[model samples]
Target chain A: MIDQPARARDFGQSRPHAGENPPFLLTTSSPGRSQRRLAVCVLVVLVGALVVTAPFARIPLENTEALLPAYAAAVFVNEVITASLLLALFSVQRSRAVFALSIGYLFSGVMVIPWALTFPGVFESLGLPDAGLQSTAAIATLRRLGFPIFVLAYALLEDSGSSARVSHGSARSVILAGVAGVVAIACGSTWLIVTSDDALPGFMKDTRNVAAPWQYVPATAVCLYLVGLCVLWIRPRSVLNLWLMVVLCTLLIEIVILSYLSAGLRLSLGWWAGRLYGLLSASLVLLVLLSEKTTLYARLVRSVSAERRAREARLTAMEALSASIAHEVNQPLASMVTNADAGLRWLGRQSPNVDEARAALKRIVDDGHRAAKVIEGITTMFKKGAQERVSVNMNRLIEETLRRCRDEARLGRISVQAELDADLPPVMGSPVQLQQVISNLVANAIDAMTAVAGRKRVICIRSARRNSDAILVSVEDSGTGLDPKYRDRIFEPFFTTRSDGMGMGLMFCQSVIEAHGGRLWVTDNEPHGAIFHFTLPSADDPPSTAGATVR
Target chain B: MVMSDDSLIAVVDDDESAREAVAGLVRSLGFLAAEFGSAADFLASDQRSRTACLIADVRMPGVTGPELYSHLMASGTPIPTVLITAYAREAARDRALKSGIRCYLAKPLDPDELLACIRSAIGDGKGRIE
Candidate 1:
């Protein structure tokens, strides 16, 4: 449905004038931000490398744990440094929540500080008769440091822009899926976990002859579920961080399945499953964490494309703009010059009674400047843009756009009318840009009335400062009314009835009005032509103070 | 201060604005300023008497200042004429002299230049421009 209509040929229905596109590229400053991020990433990698590469590592293996002295000295350093580097990168874009969490992670790594102060006789109290304390400390390093680092990554994901882009499951959906999958895995794995023992053609089952059920069933089921999940959620740009989830669920699937079947088997499946699940889930989490860079790279490319298109459109509009202004303003400029020249020549004669000529000359000079100002205004109209929100006079902008539309009204033999509300307050946005929006609407109203034979050729423009943070400008014409269903399509570019003319006038008006942090739409006019309505920011929006953006 | 057959008027313009502003000026001047948005709007408008005067813009829509004078000869609007222009180049001035316009006026115009020509026009029989 969407594909067929958009491709149809129609006058005025062309690609959007560049304004609708993203703004163009930044000048030389984009690289500065990239370089800073790169430096930080490299610093993190180097710190992590130094800690892991240090020789001799120790880990405590259970309460019966002992670690070699040299090993304790090595792996403890590796874990702490890796944890610290991750903690630093997490602080760049900060929030109170992230700040508090990173502090907790930092202190946990700080907790590893006291490991350096171990006394010589600690091995006896640690209950390691033969094994060294280094062995016990070995597992301590990962449990203490690795878990906190994972939590930090979770915090980063929650606060980033990519939060929306990442795949998400509702709390209820997750719980439902969890319970259902667990039961299904249990049934599916039961047969796999236990090998059937048959004797004498199903005469009787013998428990004494059968092996203990604590065998391969649970571990094998979990491994299979792991492989299934990997295939399900592994598409790029689908679910972020799902690979880790696939790993975690794989462990549970194996354990539950094995527990059911192990009743008929004879091995410690739980212990084996637990060991493998921990290693694999941790590996998957780290691998996903590394994928964050590519996602950011993709977003940057999208941002660049949006910018380039907007700039090109603006450039095309500007080239023809200068000539239009000169044509519009030349007459007034000529009259001003004529009056001024007459006065100057009169003064040069140095006549005794020159007061009459002097006054005429002065009026001409003043008139010349006034004429110049209007020309200046018409030419500078081409320079309009910049999205600084600010307070503006709603009534003033409406009256001015109405005044400019007088020429159009005269040419079309349309009578223009106004019902302005004096009590209207200031609205926010660029006054000139806002004027363009109003003019475009008023122009459209006049155009719609061109074919109407004789009911009424009146175009009504009204403005008000009511409604929250909004000022309204409405243009109503008496012409062929649009069907109610087609109202929404009117704002879409290239949607117009005029055969030779571009239908962009209203669409451009809509975009301009919208960009001001406002709204635009069409509705039924009073028993006649369609009404083009829009809002501007109210007085509460505040006045703008920035210079124009140079494209 | 109404116009008479013995009185001659001149108009100088190339666009619609020129027609309007000049008509307003001519009305103020107590003579007729027959307007032409172009030489075409002018030639299309009626003219009478060789005794009338012409005030032609140096650059016209069609029918150059010299050409306007040449066309006037056959039509007999035969009033002495003045040439007025924004770009008062030497070529246009020489053309006006050769074509029999008594004076060529530069733009950013002086009402005095026009008034003086009108006074001279009132007296001359052949509409000779001073």
Candidate 2:
């Protein structure tokens, strides 16, 4: 049926390498040049900030007692949101590395509340369990130590190739276990620190300065962060790895400023800047993930709309093709009906005209045969697979198509000239399909020249050996050239410039050529008009009688 | 105005088989039938003046059935035309009727209807031959 073309809709799955394939941007995709450059730019900016702030690191500012609680609140919000987003990604990807990092963020975010409550002055009204000064410092050391350790774990597991081994049902359980473990560890560490404050070392000196030994904790964290950075750099880098390196740079800068450069002062300029870097580190991956997901969403919408347009085009082509089929088949059926009536009328006469009746019956039989031929042609057009292939001489095929189109050319005032290479090899394909392709091209050429006046309308068809193994055929028209913008779109189904055109002609030609393992394209003819060219692979061995003379 | 047994009825169609079939049917009814491949062919022949009635395929390559009919009427040599179309649409039939076409018939045409249409086209009730 003519409607079968619509049912066999090509959803753009065939041409994977034709510049229309969707881009992969998640952790699975390696970082491209632009992402690498952007990461480098961020590194330069962060390092530049550190260099500028180093000289003023020792200057002490007045402590706003409210600042610690507020900073902790902001960090809590940033880390929790970042953790939730990562977890959401983990659920989709089922990646162990992402799960570890998300749990690390969750641990840090949850620990901040208790750390701030025990800090001393601002949250004293809450009567929180405060173990003098060491309480806050202990929680800070745990969070700093836990975060980099998780990063180290992430770097180790990222390329383990076990990400997809976790089934969907197990992914939920794993996520739950990770969240519960982080919460339990946070609570236990907080309970152990506040209860055993007497056994803890004094890392803070009179609430304004940190003792020298306290720097060892951040220094140890720095070492872990550096190791994680080395592991990530050694592994194949994805967009996630690229941004994580930037986040790690910020972490390195923050630790250096807070521990080494601030001269042990709690509210110094380096300390304040270090806190801001902490917030920046938490937000970087979150921001990148959000933007990448947005781009992925946009690409999805575009592809879906493109598929919808292709579907609609196939439907329209089907409708147009069936209408033409109806018109064609009805012609013979009408003739047959009239002939049968005439046959009966002749037989029914008072003086029966037997000879005339016999002629009418013969015409009816001929009409029936014509109708059957019409149906056979239609069926051959659609039955693309399992068709018998034979060695076909290209020049012979071209001559036959031109002969068939003779009346059309004469009516349209178009002169068709054939330029054949007499020594061309035979190509392997269904002869009927190849003939249809040539006929369609010739018809289109005539249609293109229908509007021309002053200039001569000439269609030049050429057949030659393209290479040792391929035969190339070109149909050129000396009419108005095709629009440059419509070069690719013209081959798309149901895309037509002609008002009365069904728009299936070029699409049919392209599909046929492609099915025969050939390529079809158009180029501008010299001075004026367009030339359509197609190439077919020559058969392995031509049959003994396959060579047909070229005219 | 009764149509005689020898009244020439012209059948024009692009399809040779359909043209011949219609001409065969007309001849069996005792009318003299002339078959043409197109309206242009019919017009080029002397049958244009002698044709008592015209049966033309509605759609053709160069000039359509309705267009040829209008051209003849405009030239002051009006011939009653019955249009047959495989690609029938209601709007086209209505427009052809409004333009003074004698009859519009769809493909796989009912022969009885065609005979009556031809009878009415040449001269209504008195046009039928004994």
Candidate 3:
């Protein structure tokens, strides 16, 4: 957790757009090109497989007694994982549609346990109370019918742009209620099917032969699956909707193979194929959700890092601006303090020289006004500044920034050369911000050269017309050439080579250039150091009178 | 208090009000006060030899206070110097002190501190003010 006081301070000072909407959820996000293609391809493959095996579906195969238990175990595990993941997503998204879908999966997964326990051959040897012959088929039919109904509920509720968000405290209760409801329904269905076993229509004439009415059960399930698929297809499809449609299609194929095409033969090729289809249907949505979560995680990491760098760059610009303003105000304040002390000294004198005392007092009053003027200038410059954009001559701006660096250049024994185009058109920007951009670049150039001893430290600044609409300025320093390893990372905040460096200078410069509708980049200055280049779009109209007065 | 007649204290700063106020304080202490707007102006002035103590702002447009002090020492006319600045960069201050500047002070200068620095700068024995 972030510290409260620090977060409160940063609330207004930084992160102006922190309250923006979070990354898109799968339920709301439209399927992308690759995702849509993959979903369609999977549906085509399932349909092709079913058609190829349809004629041979009824041919009986050797019965493996373990297959039923194993199939049930796999379905149970797959459904539970899928349902829990969907519910977890619902907890975060608080979307009612996702909650409905998850509850459906939960009910289907829980029904498998009772269906497996009551199958005639499996439990006969255990000496337990024999389950009715109809119990297994009844539970299996109910589970299949239950899933498509939930999907229909999900589709009906999936309105675009309207999130049915429950309040925070109620979200937990809502989730609990959905879970309890699924459990209650599964238990109620199992109890009713087991108690009324003899009264229910026989699904099998014997252990190996199907009854006449069993065809109606699979047909009804197939109809429900089609309705779910149709409703989902009618809605504007999101990633979640697209995958859910795939799930419904697989269920339709499973039902047709199990009863309609199997020709009343139990443990046939068609029956095994139908069970495999059921497992496939259970795994499809879970796989897509897992992969989507991974992709979203990667995107989140990149965006967070980018945001942190931008914030640091802003902090650096603020530091430089505040430092300069403080220096300006302090000069006048210092003068006033000295003047007041002088006035007091004059009055304390033995002769009490009235004229000298009065003159000293007058200077104090003047210094006080000067200090107030400094504050007033700042108020106009920043608080109400409006970041007044104007057409600025790049040559003059570069000259001013370099002049500010004159002392540092002299101390470092670096020589500066300017080859500016005299006819370069003015570009529109805030003069102070543009000044900062150039100063930061020039300062970085000087720093890059400070360690050089054998070669002369030189910085060449050039400005030229890049095209009709743009002007380019390059600061090339003959210090150490840009490190090949760090070339890309140098512009990142807090990526400094020097111990004393804050590593904010270049990042700040890049941001300022970008904000002014320009681009900044760095390249190796041939045979020696790095060349930093920036281009600004030229203003179409002639420079305004107010613009000419900025510098 | 009165300083020796031969003592001249030169005050140099890019800021007009700061220069005048520092000069005014020196004058009130009974020493001859010379004010210059920039280090370049002070360097071109004819009062370099006559000046007993130099009070200059560390940061200036053309030439800075510490630069002027170093230039004077190199030119064999090392005036006792006290460096002052509104923006007191620690690195610049340390460098100035190590180079034998008489004193290094941040702005909003205390009257007593300035007097003490000036007294020691001009050799306490020859230009003492009491």
Global lDDT of each candidate? 0.49, 0.80, 0.80
How far out, in Å, is residue A88 in model 1?
Answer: 6.1
Q: Best candidate, DockQ-wise?
A: 2
- Candidate 1 structure, TM-score to reference: 0.34
Candidate numbers, best lDDT first, in rank order: 2, 3, 1
Name the lDDT value of residue A412 in candidate 3.
67
Residue pairs in clash, model 2: none
Model 1 chain B weakest lDDT span, ten residues long: B19-28
Please provide, for model 1 over A433-527, each residue's C-alpha lDDT reduced to its tens digit, 9 standing for 90 to 100: 77777778777787788999868687777776645546787777897888777777777756777664456677778766755656787778767
lDDT for B21 (candidate 3) = 88
User: Candidate 3 clashing pairs?
Assistant: none
Candidate 1 interface CA RMSD, Å? 5.2
Q: What is the TM-score of each candidate against the true structure?
A: 0.34, 0.70, 0.70
Ranking by DockQ: 2, 3, 1
lDDT of 3 by residue, A281-386 (tens): 9999999989999988898899988987887787688688878887777777788888888888888998887898899889888878877888778656642453
RMSD of 2: 17.5
- lDDT score for residue A135 of model 2: 80
